[model samples]
Target: MLEDAGGHVRDADDDQMRLECGVFGAWNVAESSAITALGLHALQHRGQEACGIASFDGQLFHTERHMGHVGEAFSGTDLVHRLPGRYAIGHTRYATSGASVIRNVQPMFADLEASGIAIAHNGNLTNFRALHTQLVAEGSIFQSTSDSEVILHLVARSRKGSMEARFIDALSRIEGGYALLALTNECLIGARDPLGIRPLVLGELDDAYVLASETCALEMIGARFVRDIEHGEVVVISGKRTLRSSRPFPAARARPCLFEYVYFSRPDSVVNGRSVYDVRKRMGACLAQETGVDADVVVPVPDSGVPAALGFAQASGIPYELGIIRSHYMGRTFIQPTQGVRELGVRMKHSPNRQVLEGKRVVLIDDSIVRGTTSRKIVRMVREAGAREIHFRSASPPIKWPDFYGIDMPDRDKLLAARKTLAEMQEILEVDSLGFLSVDGLYHAMDAGPRDPVHPQFTDHYFTGEYPTRLLDREIAEGRNDPVERQLSLLVTA
Candidate 1:
């Protein structure tokens, strides 16, 4: 069973690492809201809980936020017409940092002294709680609990002369792995964090400038990929169809999240100049070389694990087969109010093919195992199909630490790898053997060389516990900061 943002038990949580939000913005384009809707459709896999679009039609800013998929909300021409404009920004959210309420849905708009600003953010802010506390103390009335709103308040309170200056001022005050798109009266703006932990790319669609979380969105809208917005860069695109770039933060080597190549990004996307699909295949090839079992057939866990399983099969000389078939007809938001119904939904989600699994030593390949509940159930289903032995493999390294950036991972104690040894996890899953891709092997797959003790290549804290940014909220929550120190730091940053 899945839990909603309100802590209420729901149906069909996949027990995988939840995706962060996706953001898209268009400047100086015809039917920009429609274009943004198309981009959101391509990025639907990133976040499904809610979607919102904000557009400026010269005189007034029109906004619409809805609960559910982008197709459900914006597929109709009538709804898209409601958001008429040549300048727009959109967001698809998964509630990584806020409750799944309508108020929390993003493209969060605020009316500033200079101009109305609509901001869509794609990552969690580490210093959010501290900033929120200080802002509230200073009389900032917040309508939403989302960390994205904090950015708007910061921009609203800035003493900067221009809208772009105010936006940069807000960015300089916040710390975390973030990719942001802002819609103002004068221009459309995009910004990446100092570490480039989240992705934001620049694209061109005729006379318009596009900013999206992934290149796949650009492809969906027939936008030409210009380049990736550099780390600590703020790009401003005015009505003249020109881009002005600036870097407001200290220079640092980029440390993009490793999970993008492993799971989060769409397979079709090219992130940081590397193909996501190719990276996953290389990861699987590396995994096969590291741990190969004598098996008759290699089977993917279906959908997410397919590319990696194919690479594993090719490298290990084992025949690849569709041992498990997933039901694509099942709606993601289908209601299952009870635990029994929810468990039944899980069973209905995936089924084993007896022809491939019966009387065979099967090697099961999955993207990663978080809590291991879903993995155990899949193993049981394969066993019921008469598999003689089940050797389970994870394409990515063990997720031993929780992510504070954006990916919605469970606490350390709840993670299967964090709590159990290999033998212990194998016993718990009732599999013949279980293996995970080593951390070094994963780095090699990305062609980034060995992991550096002083400065890592990627944001691999989930596996190595080497977080790229400060976790101010987590530290405060865990009582690791003194009250005096917390107040002093908040005063300086706030």
Candidate 2:
């Protein structure tokens, strides 16, 4: 269940760490809003809390933002008709920065002296609190608490000559991961951060140019996948169908989030030129090699674990089976507003199949263990189903650090691996054994060989605690009377 700004609770079960948002934009296309809606639908797994689309016709900009799934918000409505335009951008939000309020929904719009602009962002800003505090002190009025709103304020306050200049100016001052899509009357703009921590891909459909969080969005609209937007590069599609490219930031090595393959992105999506499904399967194969266990059957914790289980079974030469049946009708238990209900919701979502596990020694493959609460419950369920012995395998390395960029990871004290050893975790989960893929093993699966201790290839702070960007918020979080930390602790669980 989720709680909106109105303090009302609703059933929702998206338990994974929340991705900040998904963004899509198209330039010089008929019924641009409809195209954007389709793109957002394809990228729906990235976020599910709220969604919005903004389109710019020759005369005016039209917008529709709502708090719900993309299909429920955009299907069979005159809302598309209201947003007639040749250029548009859309966002699906998961609320990492602000409260679950209607005002916080994106395609955040602003009317500046230069022109009216609407922006949709896919990652978090690490220096948001400092910027927000400064902006508020300067008499800027904020419509919502979203960090993406800070970009608008920065652009509006810039002394730059044109909209593009102001936009670049705003991006330069910000630090952290971002894949941004902006729509204006004359152009549609797409940008990736200097480090390329988030993903943004370019695509082509007839005469139109497309920018989306993943290639799946392009596939949904029958667009041909182009290349990924380069780190620090900006592409602008003008009204006359002219495409211009610029590199505004200094050159830096790309480091896209590794978790996109492990859990966040849909298996069908391709990120940074690598197939997500292929990478996940490789992760499972690597896990099997790292710690191959003796078990009668390899069982997967349904859905997300399916691909990994296949790879594990293939590598270990053990038959794979669906030992846990997940109920698609059940909502994600993570969104349950209350602790009691959240725990109960897990049982409703998954059940063990006794027919597959009567007397077999089962090896269970899962993506990752966050708090170990759900894993513990799943182990108990398997035990009750008469499994002779249980062994748990995790596809990714131990998640020891909190994700400040976007993923809603628990605090250090709350993470199972952070507080306990591997043996301790096995005992706690009541499994015969527990194994996690090492950091180097994860890199090997990506075909990148072992990770460079001094210069890693990807942003994997969740496991390594080696953040790619400066943590300005960490300073505030460490303060004696820090409201930011308190608020984060409360909002993170929600």
Candidate 3:
């Protein structure tokens, strides 16, 4: 049952790449709702637009979704009372495949003949549009526009007798990168996509089993990390906490998203047995090796840029300093600001530190430049703070192509790197010099050897446009299908 709750929605209006969602689930744990809430807190960095939790109190499923952060949505212990259960699952959403509305907030629940299930998904299904069209033609009603809801309808309409069978049936029919959590009355299930383009970790907390998008979530709830849920693997944790595993898809090389290291995963988290923080540091060191810049100080853009800047400074033998201070409290849309004030967008989140930047040749390091709007503003801010010269460095390679998996990125045409030459980008950002880490450098930093031309070690498609899965939705949308299929699609819409 869905519970109406109050929350403060913070809209995102930035150039940073956004992960679609984060999923967390706990089985056979005391105060499972509370445990799930704690895990969601750690995964909140993955998504911030909406959050929800669904619990099964042995007999009934209780759910509460709010349009905001997990901390605000599930703030009080009263939530423990409202969602009493030892089996629970939660999701934090940013909406890449659906509108950011309360209705689309998940741990999307459905009552089926086998059981009541709540599924929380991270990443997008490339075949969602086609499947959605087919499902609608079959008279299945959908509550949310989210591609994830299509999974529910598929499972519901499956001919399979068991819940696990039906769930696998749904997964087999969908295509794309996804790490999913499903909580049913009998068991809690966790599965990762065939290529492992996304991430999910298995953990054990006392007598209970846990699953989350990142290991940081396991750490947050003091769970012992057992292992990563392997590519194309499905793990089912029974009500009695007995665990079983299956691989329902063909074996494939794991190609986890490279952005998890470059920007997405929490620095403290371990992804695929690699420390995210250490990998980012190596990325900076590689970038420094590739494009060393002479400067008075290496200044990070703050937060996400700090680790890479430290690595750059160390590698280049340049001193590191805090050239920009970020305000944590600044909401994207705090209030209606005038046009002039809106134009100073970066100033709301970041302020120049004159003491560090004044009269110095500054080397500004950032994770990556998306549209380059924020980079230009930050460059102007540093210049206004009396920096004599500014050289810009991006730890990750220029993102020339858009992502279709889960990262919310602008189209290829809108990408600054996609359209502009290196010199043009330098001139546009008004930086004395600009350099981006080479794609090979990124691979070296991740300790993945060189990127394979035929089979990449990681999903570096945002930079390389070598997407691992077929983009069925994009193909249909771009009218790249057979004429017969196009006619059928048009008729379906009509």
Worst 10 residues of 3 by lDDT: 1-10
Kindly report the root-mean-square deviation of model 2 from the true structure over all alpha carbons: 5.2
Best by lDDT: 1
Query: Which stretches of model 3 miss by more than 4 angstroms?
Result: 1-13, 96-98, 483-494
1 or 2, greater by lDDT: 1
lDDT of 2 at 104: 91
Better of 1 and 3 by TM-score: 1
Candidate 3: residue 333 Cα off by (Å): 3.4
> Model 2, 1-494: lDDT tens per residue?
45421122423333356577899999988888889999999999888889999998887888899988999899876755888878889999875323678999999999876689999998888878777887798899999878899999988988888788888988887878899988887788899999888899999999779999999999999999989999889998896668899998778989989998898888998898899999999998999999899999999887888888889999999999988999977653245567676667667878889999989999999999987878888998899899999999999999898887777666676678989999999999999999999999999989988899888999999999899987765666566436665454323210
Instruction: Give the Å shift of residue 11 in candidate 1.
Output: 7.7
lDDT (10s digit) by residue, model 3, range 1-494:
11100111222334667888999999989999999999999999999989999999999999999988888889886988999989899999885323678888998999887799899999988878888987898899889888899999988888888899889988888889999999898999899999999999999898779999999999999999999999999999995768999998778898999999989999999999999999999999999999997799999998999999999999999999998999999873466457676667778789999999999999999999988988999999999999999999999999999887888777777689999999999999999999999999999999988878888899988899888987777787778887686545434320
Sorted on lDDT, best first, the list reads 1, 3, 2
User: Tens-digit lDDT track for model 1 on 1-494?
Assistant: 45532233433445767766999999888999999999999999999899999999988899999999999989876755799889999999986323779999988998877789999999988989899999999999999888899999889888889999888888877888999999999999999999899999999998778999999999999999999999899999996688899987779999998999999999999999999999999888988999899999999997889989988998999999999999987876576777777666656779999999999999999999988989998999899999999999999998899887888777777788999999999998999999999999999989998888788989999998888877788888879988998887766642
Q: How many residue pairs clash in each candidate?
A: 0, 4, 0
Ranking by TM-score: 1, 3, 2
